[model samples]
Each structure stands twice: as C-alpha cells, then as structure tokens.
Target chain A: MDPDELEFLGEKSKIMIIPTFNKENIHLISGDLGPFRASLPSQVPLWVATLLKKQKRCKIIPPDWMNVEYLEALKEQEKQTSGFTRMPSDHYMVEAKLLLDCAPDDIPNADEVKVIIKDIWDMRMSKIRSSVTKLVKNSDFYAAVDNLTIMEINSVRPILPHALDNLFRMKHIEQPKPSQNSNVSSFLMSKRASTSFQLSNNEDY
Target chain B: MDLDDTNLEDLNDSNDSEDYVHITPAEVLELMEETWVNEKFAPEILPNKTEVVDIILEQIKSMEVNIKNLSNDDFTKNIYQLEVDKLRFMVTSYLRTRLEKIESYVVHILKEEEKRVEKGESKYLSEQEYKFAQDYSRSMDRYFNKIMNFCPNLTSDTWSSKVIEPNNNSFVFMKSKKTIEGLPIDITNADSDLVDIKSGSRVIICYSSIEELVKNGDVNLI
Candidate 1:
C-alpha cells in the first residue's frame, strides 16, 4: 500500500480539539463526535480535527506523546534498544505530518518537537535499513517484525518484498516453459493513471 | 421545529431489514473497513463482502437524506459530506482492486472456481464478477487464436495453455489477530520449524505458508 493510503487509515484515529463554535452532537456513521461547547476540549477524528483547523474553527491539542520531552526520552530509549520499540501511535508518521502541517502553533515547542521526531524517525529508519540488508543477505526464511508501525513497514516496500519473492521463485521453479505473449493490460494502465493522479493531489495537502 | 426534533439515534433502532438486524450501522462500517484492507493486501482475490457494501450504501443514502434536511450553510454538512466522500472512495477502491485482479488472472481464477464448484465450495467472485471474468477470458482466448494464426508452424503447448496466476509464494507483512501457536512454516525437516505468533505481533513471511490462516482471519496482511 502507498504511504498516503496508510495516512488515510491513520486519520481515523481520534484526537482532542477545542472548537471555537457551539454545535449539537454530530452523529457520524462511524460514531458520534460531540455537542461542542466553545473552548471545551473534545475528542474528534484526526481528519475532522484537521478539517476544523483548516477552516479556522478549532485549536488542536497535541496528543500527550507528541511533546518534546517525551519524544527526547523515547528517542534515547530507541537508541539504547537493539530491536524495534513500540510507537506511541501506530501511525506516528501520519499523526506528526498531519498535525504539525496544519497547527504548529497549537503545539508548544512545536519546532523542537518536530526536530526530535525526525531524529527518532531517522534512527529507526537506519536500524530498519541495516536489518533489511542483513535479512536479504542471509536469505532467512522468515523474520519477526513485532513493533514496527505500518508506515515504517511500508517504507521498505517494493525492495524487500520483491527481493524475497524473487529469491523464493528462483528456488521453486516448477518447469521450463516457452516464452509467450504477455502484454500489459490496457485496463490496468488507465486505472493506474487515475490512481496516480489522486495520489499527486493528496500529496499537495 | 424539525431541525431541533431530529434524532439520528432513532435510525439505528428502527431497522426494518432482517439482513442487518443483529449488527448496528457502526459495526457494518467497521466490517467494511476490515474487508477493504484485507482485500487490498492479500496476494490474490478474496471473497466479496457484497452484503456489507450494500448495507453501507443504503446507510449512505439515508445519511444524505438527513443532511438534505439541514440548511446548506450548516457547518456539520461539510463533516458529513467528508465522511460520505471517504466511504464512497473506499468502496470504489475495494471493488476496483478485485476487478483488476480478476482481469489479470481470469483464466486461473476461473479454473479454480470450477474445482470449487465441483466440490460444492463457496465462491470467491461475486455474481457480476464471475460474468466479467467469463467475458474477459473469452476475449483473451479469441485474441490468442488470432495471434497464433500469425505463426501457424509453432507446435508447442506454450502460448495456448499459459495463464497468469498470482504468486502465492510472495512475501507479505502480516499482523496476527490472535495467538496462533505451533503453526508449521516448514515441514521438510525431520524437526519441522513451527511458528508461535503472539496476538498483535507483525511478521514478514511467505504468503503460501499462512494462506489458510489469512482466509480464516487469524492474520491480516499489512
């Protein structure tokens, strides 16, 4: 799956926001949001919070783990550990990108927090890169990937999966067959065009 | 007065349809999401969730009606509209993914469907998709014969019999939904290697080793 698709799923997660206007409990198909009283914090879906912030109707309250001190400590612990550690949010990358992009001012020490998160992200990414290299070199049959979040897992996308697949296919060829006409379907081409168009549009956000 | 008196909760209680009497609309939405992700990541086509899609579409229509009752300037209208757009995109993407797979693997999937039908097993393709695959396969057969006519001297069973099939042996990232112990990944050795996957733990493994588990919802391809 694409990283944007992961972000789309991650946006379903709820976050706290302070609405500037009063409204009745907004009943959504997934669930109800709330009867918003001005200045009172209410938990809403991440997408909703971003939408409200974009409309200048709400102040986002950053999630607890998004703070500078917490992230710094977490970064230190991650450095100390040899294996992947659990992330505060399953889609931490998505949360950081969406929240920090729209409402940096709402988060105290936002710039510092952003830098620390990037530091942690880089640390974990390098660890993954080294592990992936080791995995492909040894041609291990399988590997446990317990604590890596979805976005981090996706970063190793086509390379890791394709390499492992090719290795397995090489080992398990059934029979030698003559070359045949295998043309790329035109249907897929058009579909891919539209999909990429949507991706580029979302990237602008 | 209608605006003040409207109660969205009432829609949840007044379910006249026996098809979805047991589960609430929210649960239906949740099931749709799970189905969408599972279908997206699985190496091959999965069983269609036609019932869930139908229910959600019905609910979307109902929601649209409710929204229409509100004035255009209502801020809540945009929120509701956003959700409807998301749901619409999800359903379209899910169905499109399946259709793409079907077209790509039409012959192989049809042959698999034949065996499943012979054994009285449930089918993976929906009724409309089956029709689509049949039509596509016929066209491919015609196209192949036309191509073979250009080279009539070839005497091999190569071009006539080859069909595109999904690589089941491909590696995929998966998260176990429950603790599944003693699962055999390899049985060639005298002391076979068994995997013990704790609930919520992720792994990168060959899809064929755990294809059945995935079908049974024990594990989800990330």
Candidate 2:
C-alpha cells in the first residue's frame, strides 16, 4: 500500500481542533462535526481538521503524544528494547506525519518533535530490517509481528511476503503428509501487489 | 444503476426478516473503509459487499443533493462539499482496487467461484463482476488463440495453466479480531506451531493458514 493511502486511513483518527468560525453541526455521513464556537476546541477527524486548517478556519491541537519530551522517552525505550516497542497508537506514524505536515505551528517545539519522531521511525525501521533478515534465513515458519504499525508493515510488503513465499516453495516441506500440494501453488508470488487504484480523474464535488 | 433502493438495514441480518431498521450513514462509512483496507490487503478476492457499498453511495448522492440546495454564499457549503469528495474518494478507491484484482486473477477467480458454487457457498463475486471476469477470460483466450496460430500447438488449456495466480501462501501481517485457541500456523510439519492468538494481537502468518479466518473477518491483514 502507498504511504499516502495509509495516511488517508490514518486521517480518520479524531483530533482536537479550534475553529475560528461558529456554525451548526455539519451533518456528514461519516459523522457530525462542530457547532463551532470561536476559539473553543472540538474533536473532529484529522481530515476535517486539515481541510479547516487549510481554509484558515481552524487551529489544530496536536495530540498529547506528539510532544517532543514524550517521544524522546519513547525513542529511548525503543532503542533499549530488542523487540519492536508498541507504538502509542496503531497509526502513530500516520497521525504524526499528517499533523506535522499540515499544522506545524500548532504544535509546541514542532521542530524537536519532528526530529524525535524521525529518530523513532529510523530506529524501528532498522529493527524491522534486522528482524526480517533473521526471519528469512531461519527455519521458523512464521514470526509474531506484534507492535508493528500499518506503515511499517506496508514497507516490508510484496517483498517480504514474496521472499518468504519463494522460500516456502523451494522448501516445499521436505517431510511427507502435507495436506495440500505445494507444487500446485505459485512458485513466485507476483512482485506487483496490485497497484493502488489511481484517482486522478476524480469528479469535483 | 438507478440506485433508488437506498433503504438502509438494521443489525438484524436474519434472512427471513422483511424489515428495515434505522442505521446511520456514519456507521456504514466506517464499515466501508474497513472493507476497503481488507480488500486492499487480502491475497484473494473477498465476498461481494455490493449491498453495503450501494447503501453508502446512495447516502452520498442524497448528501450531494442537499448540498446543492444550499445558498452559494453559505460557508457550510465547502464543508459538505469536502465531505462528499472524501467519501467518493474512499468508495472509488475501494472499487478500483477490487477491479484491479479481478482483472489480474480472472481465471483463478472464476475457477474458485465454480468450486464455491458446487459447495452451495455464497459467491465472492457479484453478478456484474462475474460477468466481467467471464468476458475478460474469453477475450484473453481469443487473444491467446490468435497468438497461438503462429505457434506449434497452443490452446486455452495451455493458457490457463500459464495464468499468474495470487499466492495464498504469502505471509501477511494480521491483527486478530478474535481469540482462537490453537490456531494452526503451518501444518506441513507434524508438530506445527499451534498457539492461541488473542483478540487484538498482531502476528505475521501465512495467509493460507488463516484464510478461513480472514474470510469470516476474524483477522484483518495490515
């Protein structure tokens, strides 16, 4: 999956935003948003907050975990742990990236927060790289991938799965009594993990 | 499609019930997003969710109509317009992803659809999709035969044999939606790893091992 697509999914997470304009609740199919009282903070999906922010209608209130100090501690723990440290949220990277991208000014010490988040991401990626190498070389059939976020998982995709699949094909369980025929299945899973559908010709709404 | 039958259904999914209950469009949108991501990741095509999709699309259309009635200078217009655009993006992306899979795995999908029919199972492909697959398969066959005329004995059978199929054995990182005792990891080994996968636990496992669970929505591939 493309990082943008993952970010799209991540945009669904509700976050606090202070709207400058007052309006009745905007009824949307996904959910309702704001009877915006000026300068009063309300929680809305990140996507909504982004558009409002872009239109200069709202100020994004960064999530509590987006703080530099908290992330620095998290990064320290991530480095100390041999295994992947559980992220603050399943879409932590996604939320961080989107929030940071759209409203850097809303966040305090935004620069420091950005640096620490990247550090955490880099550390996690290195861990995933080493772990993947170990998994591919080992005889273990599967590994528990606890704490890996969607973006991290997507990074290893088509490659990791296909590589393991090819290994499985070559091995084909040297022993007997396999329920199904390994020879019958794909020798190599297609490198193309189906392109993310193009949306360039989108109808203006 | 006229899409006039925009009536939404309640939680009671029993086949015999001829009833309609109030279900908010909000809930439907969330379900659609989940289905979209699941379809995007699953190695094989999933059961058709056209009914749910139709309902959501219907809601979007109605929303659009309402937005059109708003005064030109209304500030709320942009918000509604933006929401509609985003919803359309989500739905279209879901559909386009499915279509790509259908085109790539036409032969494989048709074959499995037949097997599923024999077992009296619900179809994975909708009627329109099934037709599309058949037509695609036929056209590919014709193209193959046309090319084969210059070759030394090639047939549709040969073409089918060479079709690139989705590898179900591929590993996927899945978040378990339910706790299953002794879930089988790989059965090739006599003492295959069989561990309890608790609800909300994430793991990397062979798709073939949890294919059934995936279809039943017990796990979501990340």
Candidate 3:
C-alpha cells in the first residue's frame, strides 16, 4: 500500500469505546470501525486513550447497529464531559463525518480531499478575516468575539502552502477610502487672498 | 422849610411842576470840563469816530466776560465748551477789529447826518432802510455769538452711498476732518462707535454704527 493509503487505513481501523461499570444491562455494538476511525485525526486516539484510562473499571466495546442507542448515550456523555455541545460553524466536522461514512475502497483521493478541506478552510478564514477587519475598524472587537467562536480542528491532510499564504495575506487589511470634496481648498485660498488684499491696502494708505 | 421866602417858594413851585430840568449841549460841555478839570482833555464836543469804536469794543469785551462766566461750571467742562470758548474769543477779537472799522464809517455817516440836519435836510434814510440796518446788526450780533461759542462741526453734504456684495465682508471706512482746524482722521468699519481722534491740538469725531460700517464696506475712495 502507498504510505498515504496505509496511514488512511490505520486511522479508519481505530475505534473509540465507552463502558458502563454495571453488568445488569450490558449493551454493545460491534462493527468494522475502520472508516469511522479513519474519519478522525491521530489526536482522537490520544483522547480515547485518556478517556479509557480515566474510567478504568468500565468496559470498552466495539460499536454496531444493535447498540446504536448505547453509542448515542456514550456520545452524549462525551459531549457533556468535553463541554462542547456543537461544532462551530467554521469547523469541518460535518464534512469529516460525511467522509467517514464512505467505505475505504470508495474514499476520494487524499489529495482531492486535502484540496476540498483547504478550499473550505481558506473560504472560512477569508470570511473571518473580513469580519475581524470590519469589527476592528468600527471599534467593535469585543462584539465580534462575543458573536463568533474561533476553534482549531486537526486534519490528516496537510494544507497547501499557497492556500496558507492566501489566508495570511487576507489578514493584512486596508482602510476604507475617504469621501472627496475638491472645492474646499479653492474656497479657502480665495478667502486668504482677500485678507491679504485688505492688509496691504491698510499699509498703502 | 423856607417856603415863606419868595425865591425859595418859586424854586419849590418849579420842582413840583411837570417840567423837569433838561441838560443842554452847553451844560454837557460844561460838565465835561468839570470832569476833566486837571487834564488838558476836552470831552469830544461831538462824538468822534474812534470813540464809537471804543464803545463797541468795550461792549464786546463785557459780553465775552458774561459768556465765559456763565460757562465756568463743571457741567460745561467738555469738548463742546472748549470749542465754544475758542469760538467766542475768535469772534470777539474779529468783531472788535471789524467794529473799529464800522465805527469810523458810522462816524462819517453821523457827520453827514449832522450836515443834513444843519441844511434842514429830511428823509436821509428811509424807514425801511433804517429798520433793515437795525435788523441786520441784531442778526450779525446773534450769529457772531453763536459762531464764537458753539463752533459746531456740521456737514453740508451727505455721505456717498456704498454698495457691497455679499462675499465682500469688509469693514467700512469713514473719512473725518475737523472744520475749525483741518485735521484728517481715518475710521475703520470695525470701529463703529463714536471715536475721538486728536490731530494736532484739535479733536476729530467720527460716529457710525457697527452694522452701517460693515454693510457699507465698499466706498469710492476718490
């Protein structure tokens, strides 16, 4: 397998599991976790390992259709523990999840996926930069931060240098053009001329 | 008390009568001699031309004294009073010299009158001519006093109207000159109130409102 393909398969093969300590009702779902694991970046495994270590007595099981309700409960618990109710608008979570549902053999080219992610990230960053510039100009930085949440999401694909450069350039903003009035200078000049005339006349006579 | 005496009774009766003692030219001449006894001076048997000039000069001096004393109070301590005093002095001096000349002329006229009377001439001056002379003298005296005392500065002509455009927002210029002593004073439009400017020893006054000056900023200098 290509190194990139092997990395993709290894990511998909990993699973995240949660356990209930009590044996009175044991619900489980076991499935091919490859695609789901592949959907997450390498950081998800570390999160899963930490969670499992923290709950040592609970069982860790594979998720399947038979235990869908249990999986949902686990997800709810994870959300509560992480204190994150929803993904931010600019996050690529939904798209990543959609990709996860596809079979590994049917996955889009890694480069193609990377391109899509970069395009989305670039677009999102551009919007944020514009909004930030406007807020700063208006002296409304606090309001802007209160209205929008900024977050970081990891991706298995690397962002292109050109796309990164474009996003960085967008941050360097320009001030709006001032309104033009051409006649004011002329009026002032004429006034000055008249004053000089008056002064000179006084000196002459 | 001596009424029993004939001469005293006659004197008392004469004094009580309607007819009073009259002074004749002979008596006047005799009295003049008595007044000038120690001196070789004779009272002019007839009034001389110089005597008339002296009389007029004395009258003018007395009038000036009266006017000066009347205006001595603090209430009269102002530029107007000073001007009045100056005018009075000028007129008095002028009139004194003028009256001297006039007296000589009058003396000549009186001599002619006497000659006409001797010749039994009548109607030397018509009634109208005499009245007109009297009125003219009175008017001259009154005007002399006024001119001497007040010295009022008045303009015989109106100021030229100035037209100004809206954009030309400048001050008005008022040219003032003293009448008695010619002194020029330039007053700008900004100084709208009455301004007293001293040129030499005389004061030139300029009076105008701020509005009028600003409005009439443009004036024909010529």
Candidate 4:
C-alpha cells in the first residue's frame, strides 16, 4: 500500500454530526460518504469531524476504548498478562489523546481517560526499562523478543543501539585504532562532564 | 430567448456537477496562516483584510456534511482524522504565535510606562490608546483562556508537574541563544557561580530541567 494509505489507516477517529444541510451520496477519492440528514450520527474521517466540531457544527463521539471504565479494565487485563494483550484499536491511544485535547467536552470522562492512559504508559515504560537494562547487562545483542510492541521497541531504540555498539567495542578491544579510540573517549568525556554537572545540581533541589 | 435559456442551462450545469476538491487541513491552515507572519512583525503593513477566516470556516462547515455519508476502510478515515488533528494544531499555533507577539509588545510597553511613571511623567497612554490597549489585552486574555479551555493539557500544571526522575543526567548541546541564570564564571573562578554557557557549548544538564528548554528551542539533546 502507498504511504498515504498507510497513514490514513493509522489516524482514523470516530465522531458524531448534527448536520444542517442535506447532501446526497458524495464520491470521494478514499471512499463513498453520506446522504447527510439533520441530527444523525454518521462516521466521517477525523479531520472532517474536527473541522465541524471547531465550527460548532458537530459533536465528537468518544470511541468505546476511550471510556475510563473500559480502560481501567483493560489495564487490569494488561497487568495480568505476561504476554501482550490486544489493544482496542491499533492507534486508540493516540486517537483518544488527540480527541481529548481537541474536543474534551465531546468525550465523556476525558480527564479520567488521560489519567488511565498515563497509568498504562507508565506501567509499560517501567517494564520496557527493566527489560532494556537486563538486555544490556546480558549483552544479548541478537536476541529479539516477539512480545514487544512496536511502540515498546521504539521506546528503547534511542539508547539500545549505542549500548550494543559499546558492548561490541568492549568485546573486540584488540584491533582498535588509537585515533578512533581517542575520538570516542573525548565524546564519552563530554558526556561524563554533563552528568557531573547534573549530579551537582541535584543536591541544590 | 435563446441567450436566456443558455445562461439558465449553464447555471444548472454548474450546480449539478459541483466539483468538490479534497483539501487537507494543513493546506487550509497554511493558507490561513500566511497573513500572520507579516502581522506579527509589521502589523502596519497589513492590508484592510478580507474576512477570509469566515470563508474558511464555512468550508469547514461543508466538510462536516461531506464526511457524514462516507464509508471507507479504517485507514482512510484515520488519515482524515489525522488531518483534523493537524488542523486543530495549526489553529492553536496560529493563535499562540499572535498572542506571543501581543504579550511581548504589551509587556514592554507596560514596563516602559511604569518607568515613565517612576520618572514623574504624567501620561502613558492617551484616552483612545488606553482604551485600545485595554481592549487588546482583554481579547488576548480571552483567546488565551479559550485555548487553555479547549486544550486542557496546555496548562503547565497539568503536564509539567509529572517529573519522575529529576536527576537523570543527559548531555545537551545548546542550539539557540539562552541565558543561564547566574553570574558569569571562568574555570579558575573560586566560586561555581561564574559559568556561562552558550551556543556550541555542551553541558550535562539534569534531564528533567532541560526537558522544557529542549522543547522551547534553547537546547538540543545530544
């Protein structure tokens, strides 16, 4: 599929409209939409819904996954699973966040949704952090776990590559060029200097 | 009678096959935002503006109706929603950019007026200018309040207070101009207070403290 199609799939949000004008079935590049009538809830692309909402023409309907009660239950399910639990939608978290930010009034219990999402994020991050540290300690660079979600893997990508590279360098210390080693040492020194500054500042607060 | 019929026929054809162009929210937002770049720096050079915002808003209204009857795969709908997010983001940013300009100018003026008052100057603003300033500030406040209400997460307290690890160390390379809060210092200085870092300087800063700075364009994560 084209990148446009891929991105379109990634961002769908559900919303409700109370239209003032009637329009027959309109053919769009993506698909067919509506014979719109007044006060009926129909699904539209999120962009259309948001635009309407901004104009006070429509109200957004929160998706089922956005409900605090549902999320809390899902979080419980996630907690019980040592393996990955299915999410309500592929992009529910991002979609819910966007809706909550843009049209909080349309989404019921938005503040609760935010809190629950954050709780889930924190739990996932903590798990990922521990696993990442363990991976580094074991120096199992080639190991790939099937359980990690794309988001989870991406969270560690920032530090993991560097950590693995460092491990590789340590294992093959015999043939290291002097100039390259110096360059890497200087970079490490700069990093150390910054950390020292941070350590000093920590005492003040 | 032939000419009148032809004209009537043309109108009917135009209405029957109204070619609706697909527009991404970003494109509409960018078109709306073009005027503000000049307005921020040179408000005087701005034209007697047309009410184009109303027109764009009307287009958005029509788009709402258009979306209602569509049945597409999940992907297309998501892409559409993403565009909406971008539209809202652009609108928020547009308002914020103007508000920033207004705030900085008003604050500078108010400060200058205060200094003048301290120096025993009688008048800061004339009656009309005073009224205009009051109205301007009120509108600025109103717009700001509206955005805060619309995006509750925009409030600093909502997001900023969640600092889990304050002392997590990270290196930061300064990107733009920033003044660190302290007296300038050299390495040989007996006191630690004299250090002043600038662009091209790499410093290890606590991750939590640098988070806001990185977001604000003052530093780059290294």
Candidate 5:
C-alpha cells in the first residue's frame, strides 16, 4: 500500500509507526503488516481474540516500539468511547421515574416515554435477580408503570379519573388511603355512568 | 309699649350670647386659607435619572473607601480566615452593585433608543456605536462568568483559602467525597456515569447518555 493510504488509516486509528535500523529492508517487509499492527493498541492482541481468526498476512511486531503514542492513542479512544456511552440502565430508570413523578402534568412525547420504559426493561434483563425482584416489588416502579400505561391508554381516548384510579389501585404496591377530596372521582363516575347508559340505550335501539 | 319691650328682649339675648360665642368674617377666611394650604396638590414624586445615578456613584465611592481600608488593615490574629472572608464579601458586594448599575444604565440607554425610534429618528446605530455596545456587553459577560467561577473557591474556607493562610498547617479538607481518598481516576473521569463504588456509589449521568439511550433500542419508549 502507498504511504498516503497507510497514513490515512493510521490517523483514523490514531496510531503512528516508525521504522528503525535497516530502513530499506524493514520498510519493504513492514509496509505490508506494520501499519495494520500499528493501528492497534498493545492490548489489542489479548482483547481481540478474532485477530487469529482472520487470515495471517505477517508476524505481529514486538511491544517495545509501540511507545507512548500507542498508549495515548488507546487512552483517547477509550475516553471517546466512555464519554458517549449510555448510562447504566438502572440509573436511567431511576432518573426517568424521578422526572415523571416530579412533573406528571407535563407529559413528554412518545419518544421520551419509550426511553424510560426501555431503561426499566434493561434493568429487568441485566440486574441481579434479587435486585430485579426488589425493583418489581418497589412501589415507585409500579406507580411509574401505571402512570405510563394510563397515559398510553389516554392517548387513544380521553382520560377518565375512574380509569386512572383503577390503574393506580391495581398497580400501587402500598396504596395510599382514599381522601375526602373526591372531585376527580365524582366527575369520572358520573361521566362513565352516563356513557355506559347511553351505549346500552343505543344497543337496545 | 309692646315694640319697646320686644327690642329690649332681643338686645338682652344678643348681649348674653356674645360673652360665650364669637364669630368674625376675617377669621373664617383665615381658616379656609389654612385648609387650602395644608391640602396643596402637586405632581407625583420621582427621583430624576441624574439624581439616581449620582446616589449610586456616591455609594460606590464609599464602598471603594471601605475596601481600601480593609486591604490596609493588620488582621494578624485569625488573619488568614478574616482576610479571605472579608475579601470574598467585598468582591461579591462590589460585583452585585456594579452589575446593577450596568443593567440600569443599559435600560436607560435602551429607553432613549426606543424614544428615538418612536420619533422616526435613526432606528439603527452607526457601526462604531454598535461595535462599542457589543464589546461592552461581551466584556461584562466575560467578567461575570469569571467572577461566578471564582465565587465557589473564594467562599470555601477549605479550598483556595488554606493556600494563603499564615501557619500553612491548616488541613484543607476536600468537600467532595470523590477527592477525599485521592483516587487514581482522572478529574474528568469523576464526571462520568461510572460509579466509584468505594465512594458510596455516587452515580452521575451526562445528557449525552440520555441521547444515546434514545438512539439505541434500549430507550424506545420515549
């Protein structure tokens, strides 16, 4: 390969190679494989088991010439990767739950809602079984799930307080006792009763 | 004989009442004038812009003198702690007043500009004037940012204050739990989502994490 192509690959991989001693003979042999190996970090051999699986073109270079640049390149790569990585699933779920609880009135769009549900799902899949069970048993998780489900159901039809109350009661791990302020309850009961009565009348006709 | 009796009777009543009650046209007029004087109408009182500016400048001059005196004082006993506290308070007070003054001045200028615009005068300023205004705003913003960044350090007795203390024996405790043990992790790394489990599992996730989760199928429900 041409030096330009090798340099382009080196830059992309964040690695640089330097030939030593017999530059001509070494360059001729190294040009084929030196750039490829130079493009990888020292840990590449150990971490990447698939390297042996690929067709062998040349011998792997010794570790000494890899130098500080190789280490720095690896560090930069790791930094970039970690900087953009997803937060742990459990943490994301907790954050979503907190946000939803704090501002339930200001419902986020479908996309945002999905993100929260996914975090809960991921937590269920990856977390320790006991921890998962604890989460499943947790009152907050169920409340969040109920709130989300009610919101989803409401997206199709106008939300009735009766439906919301039922959902809350069904899913709530330790449900709070009903209070005297039953404005929402009364409104929902009247509306649902009137609607059902009208439907029955229509069916008889 | 009857007319003379009636006249005599009226005279007697007037004389009796005169000793207990008296009235004069001049005195009534004088009372009316006094009432008018007391209830004198006038326009609503407001400080003139120039007067307000003068008051602020005077207060600033006084503060400058106070700051000068503070700087010159021999605060030897508990000198280090006193100096830092005084300096911080002084700086914060100064910045607050300065910012207020700048804001007021800007408002005044803008109001004038608005009036000019209403009169169909030049709505846009000359290039030089615009540049000057922009530069002033930019400089103020920069100064404000610098002051805000330095505020936490200045106020905290354990952080930058210990460096200037006389004895140098005062142990500067790191308020952040992450730094108390002096772990090998990078300072930037401390800001990452990875919990330092040893440090009580202090978890932090950046905005980027949420964005990524949204991109990936993991957070499809949003």
Candidate 6:
C-alpha cells in the first residue's frame, strides 16, 4: 500500500447521512463502507464523508476529537505533561480544519471547538519554537524529540529544514563578519522561492 | 598489501579502486536530497538520482554476493554487513522522501498552473522549473517501470494511463464519494470503468464536472 494511503487509513471521519437509496455496501481499496441508511450516522474516510456532506446526501457528525471539552482537557494535559499526549489521528488538524471550514453548521459549538483546538495548537507550537531556538543557540548537531506530531512538523516545514541546512553550512564555513554574514543568510533565505520565475540571479542552484 | 609504500600519497593511491567503485551512499543520498529540495524548483543542478539509486542497488547486491565467498572471518564479515545495512537504510529513506515529494509535486503543478491561468497570470513555468518537472516526471516513470519489472502483476492498464497521460487537460475518473460544484481537480483512475456512482460509489466524469465538488469537499480527484 502507498504510504499516504496507510497514513489516511487511520483518519476516518464519522458522518450522519440521509442516503437516496438503501445501499448494501461499497468496497473501496481503503476499506468497506457499509449499508448506508437514511438519517443514520456512519464512519467513513474524511475524504468520503466530506464529499457526501457537500452533496447534501449526508450531514457530518463532528468527530469526538473536535469536542471543545476534549480539546480543553487535551490542552491542559499538554501543559502539564513534559511528553506528548496522543491525538485522535495523525491528520487530525488537517481533518478538523477541513470539516470546520466546510461544514461548520454540523459541528456543535464550532466556534468554541475552533478556539480550544487553536489554543492547544499554539501551546504545542510555542513549545516547539522554544526548543528549536535553544537548539539553534546551542549549536546542537542532534536533538531527539519524542512524540512530535506530524502537523507540528509540517507547520514548521517551511523554516526548520532550511534552517538546519543553513546551520550546517555555517558550521563548516569561516565567518564573513556580522554584517556580511547577515547579508549572506538573507540571500540564502530569499532563494527559497515559491515559484521558478521568481528566481534571483545570484541563486547557486 | 604493499609494505614499501609508506608515503601518504602512495597510501591514498592504493585504495584508488575502492574510491572509484565505492561512492559513499550517504553522499549520494545527500546529493539526491539537495536536488529534490533545491533544484526541484529550478533546473540548475541535475544529479541523476534515479541512475544513482540503480547503481547503488547493483553495488550492494554484488557486495552481498562477494561477502558470501570470503573466509570465516566473522569480525570482518560483520563489519561489511553493517556497512551494507547502513547503505540500504540510507537508500530506502532517500527514495521514500523523494517519492513523497514527487507525488505531491505532480498534483501541485497541475493545480498551481490552473490557478495561475485563471488569475490571468502567465501560466507557463519558468524554463528551469519546467525542466525540473520533466526530470521529476521521468524519474517517476522510471521508478514505476522498475516496480512493474519486479512485479508484473501489479502493472495495470489504468496505472500506466494515469501516470503517462500528462497532456490530457481533462480526465475522467470515479468519484469515491459525493462532492459539490466549482473547485479544481487532481487526476486519477483514467481508464477505470464508469459505474453508477452514489456516495461511496464509482462514477466516470471529467475534471470540470467535479471542480466544485473537489473544492467544496464532495469528491476526491482520484
């Protein structure tokens, strides 16, 4: 199986739907989605549930993880524990964002849920930021982080990897003095362009 | 094996064959990673990653066979095995990371170009990015070919059609679930049969039919 598919397999979304017809079952490569009945809740992949909800064939039952109470507790646990706590799924943040954006009406206390999720997310992110800053300041070559979420890593993807690369370069090369060094670093950062046509002439690659 | 060659230059010259034949897998992996991370957006650096992977695999395989023929020197054999394992690990990690980016890039470019066109911006990729895209596409093609070579049963008409038909502006595919109207699409399952698609049922439709469905969250592109 594809790695993406494997990752997605755990990201099933619960949805309440009113089917046009009484379908027995649908066998998909991901798994079998079964015996859909009108006005009943069923578990389906996030992609499928989102589609059904959009077409008015079904309404989404916001997953348990999206509950404001649960999120608040999660945030508390995150604050108290030195280690990471479990999330409902690997792609929970992306899934939550998708559902909240598309079907806000379906989710209960949608605004509150959003705030709590954001709170937990920000708390986690701030912790990540501090650790990363420490690593940079101390010039640590390797630091093992336990249970860092995929979303957390992805959120910092644009900077962290490139920062590490720059750090690696800095370690080997002699310093060019402070002002010249700042210019070089800024030049390097600017090379990380979103598009090809925006390339600067001084880009090494 | 030469006792008289005491100079550093002579010592370095003795391992010339090992130097020529045995490129460090970590270096290859690093070069490939750089090509993926930096050169992917522009065609400035072209390290043939696909070819490098192939050469590494062949080298590892031959080394495995050679190690089997050595004397019962468990100490040396264990070290050789350890080095080979490290190389294998590096290659696996490198390929996994690169392929993930390649798959995402394929989807990204299609959607990105479409958005650019709709926004009345110049939709054409810079010659460098276009070249990089071509290289990536070719690498993907080669990767799939190698997979099919190893496991012919996995090769299906649909798989090839989906990957190779890059020029088709609109694609017909099945909807895994219901979706709304007016969003863009990613291509998938081009040659599959059209069936009566309901929620979680398959349907055959073009890209535009499901644009909104794709954007509004009714259907997946694949």
Each prediction's number of clashing residue pairs: 0, 0, 11, 17, 10, 9
DockQ of each: 0.32, 0.34, 0.00, 0.04, 0.01, 0.02
lDDT of 6 by residue, B112-155 (tens): 56687799865344444456666876777777777777675667
Q: Please give, for residues B139-187, the per-residue lDDT of candidate 4 as tens digits.
A: 7667666667878557733322222211122312222246554422221
As for candidate 5, its clashing pairs are A110-B222, A111-B222, A112-B222, A113-B221, A113-B222, A114-B220, A114-B221, A114-B222, A115-B221, A115-B222
The docking category that best describes candidate 5 is incorrect
lDDT (tens digit, per residue) of candidate 1 on B1-222: 122112223333433433334566677777788788878767678877777777677767778888888898898899998998888988898999999888776777898999999999878898999999999888877777777777877533344354455756667888999998987654323465788989998998877788888877788888
- The residue-by-residue lDDT of candidate 2 on B86-179, one tens digit each, is 8888889888777878888888789999999999987899888888889998999899888887877555466676445776766777888888
Residue A205 of model 3: what lDDT?
21
Off by over 4 Å in 6: A1-21, A27-29, A174-205, B1-222
Comparing candidate 5 with candidate 6, which one achieves the higher TM-score? 6
Among all candidates shown, the one with the greatest DockQ: 2
On the 0 to 100 scale, the lDDT of residue B147 in model 5 is 70
| Candidate with best TM-score | 2
Per-residue lDDT of model 1, residues A1-205, tens digit only: 7777898889999999999999989999888888899999999999999999999999999999999889988999999999987899999999999999999999999899899999989999999999999999987768999889999988997678778876655544343323332231111122221111101111212
Which DockQ-derived CAPRI band holds candidate 4? incorrect
- lDDT for residue B156 in candidate 4, whole number 0-100: 31
Ranking by lDDT: 1, 2, 6, 4, 3, 5
lDDT values of the candidates? 0.78, 0.78, 0.28, 0.47, 0.28, 0.50
RMSD of 5: 37.1
How much lDDT does candidate 5 score? 0.28
lDDT measured at residue A14 in model 6 versus the true structure, 0 to 100? 44
Tell me how many residue pairs clash in candidate 3. 11
Q: Residue B217, candidate 5: how far off, in angstroms? A: 14
Docking class of 3: incorrect
Candidate 4 segments exceeding 4 Å error:
A1-9, A13-21, A25-28, A143-152, A168-205, B1-222
